[model samples]
Target: MAREGRQWSDFEIAVSDYLTTLREKAGEPSYRRLAELTGIKFSRLRDIFTKQNGTPTLQEFIDLCLTFGKDPADVIYKIMKDLEAKGISLSNIPAQNDPADEANAALASADNGVDIDAWADRIKAEDSVHEEQP
Candidate 1:
């Protein structure tokens, strides 16, 4: 439950979507039955199914994957690799208490006044000077 509401991270959405597919393949078992098999409460399973928990806990994810006869590592690796192709990762999620500050910090990092273009130009000028010397 680290994240919730409209701010669901890509990782969370991916996990939820993956589990949904797994559930479907496993005959779409009832939450009650899943609870009995997984030892996770039916209510919690419902929340996970509805995505009300934002993202399932690592344990819950692993348990569900196992229950569905899927390998959690394989599923997670595939999902992470796909997300990585899009330049996204689970680490991108901000803290729960005050995410605005974290977002603002990311924005702030873009304007740190380190002018790379200027440095490149300077390096080019130095290279030309060295060429003239040799």
Candidate 2:
């Protein structure tokens, strides 16, 4: 269990160190360079990776990690452990089996004679339409 009033847990330290290694491997770029490449602003990136209080959205962290050719699971594990250390109950967290689940589900649905590809294409088209609205 984490001590009360600690700024960071062991997992947080590991995550920070992991991110540091990633940044170093990517030619030791500045925060601004990481932001430009990963679509995360410098301040927000600093807040997520360097600061302690604010929690990053899972998608943002996953994307940023992926942009550096790193594994997403490691980052997620670090976050999960941090939450655990804080005594947060995780009984309600949904299952996240694998990244290919969506595609696999689509294929499985098609096996039952459903037009999964058409549905996926429709979703893509609808997303494009929504993207154009702004």
Candidate 3:
């Protein structure tokens, strides 16, 4: 049973939730197996899951995401959405660039044989249209 009046940090809750989902999706692999696959210590992973004084480093988080074949950005977006649904303000978090800026940067660096500037322009136009919707 959880303690009453215990306030969980956003990072703690988000990471716990994300780990639970991953475990469920993976059919609940053994902690040892997960540690081997993700290059994280089993003891550390166990501590984090049990909220026993373990916080994952960014590299560890990224490694776990890759092990689960998930995009880190998608995970971050989901966590942000969950926080918003709970009426939790994320003002303490550093501001990120608008999604449009990220899209444009990705397009500019993509080596997929498409014209970077043209793709960026198309993305900007699409974003403008989306903003005008509803």
> What are the lDDT figures for the candidates, one per model?
0.82, 0.73, 0.79
Clashes of each: 0, 0, 0
**TM-score for each prediction?**
0.58, 0.47, 0.63
- Put down candidate 2 lDDT per residue, 13-81, tens digits, no spaces: 556667777787878888798888888888877766674555556677677789888789976676676
The candidate maximizing lDDT is: 1
Flag regions of model 3 displaced more than 4 Å: 1-8, 95-134
lDDT of 1 by residue, 11-105 (tens): 87888888888889889999999999999999988888878854588899999999988899899778887787888855764423568887768
Model 3 is weakest, by summed lDDT over 10 consecutive residues, at 2-11
Comparing 1 with 2 on TM-score, the higher-scoring candidate is 1
**How should the candidates be ordered by lDDT, best one leading?**
1, 3, 2
Off by over 4 Å in 1: 1-7, 86-134
Model 2 misplaced stretches (Cα beyond 4 Å): 1-8, 74-134
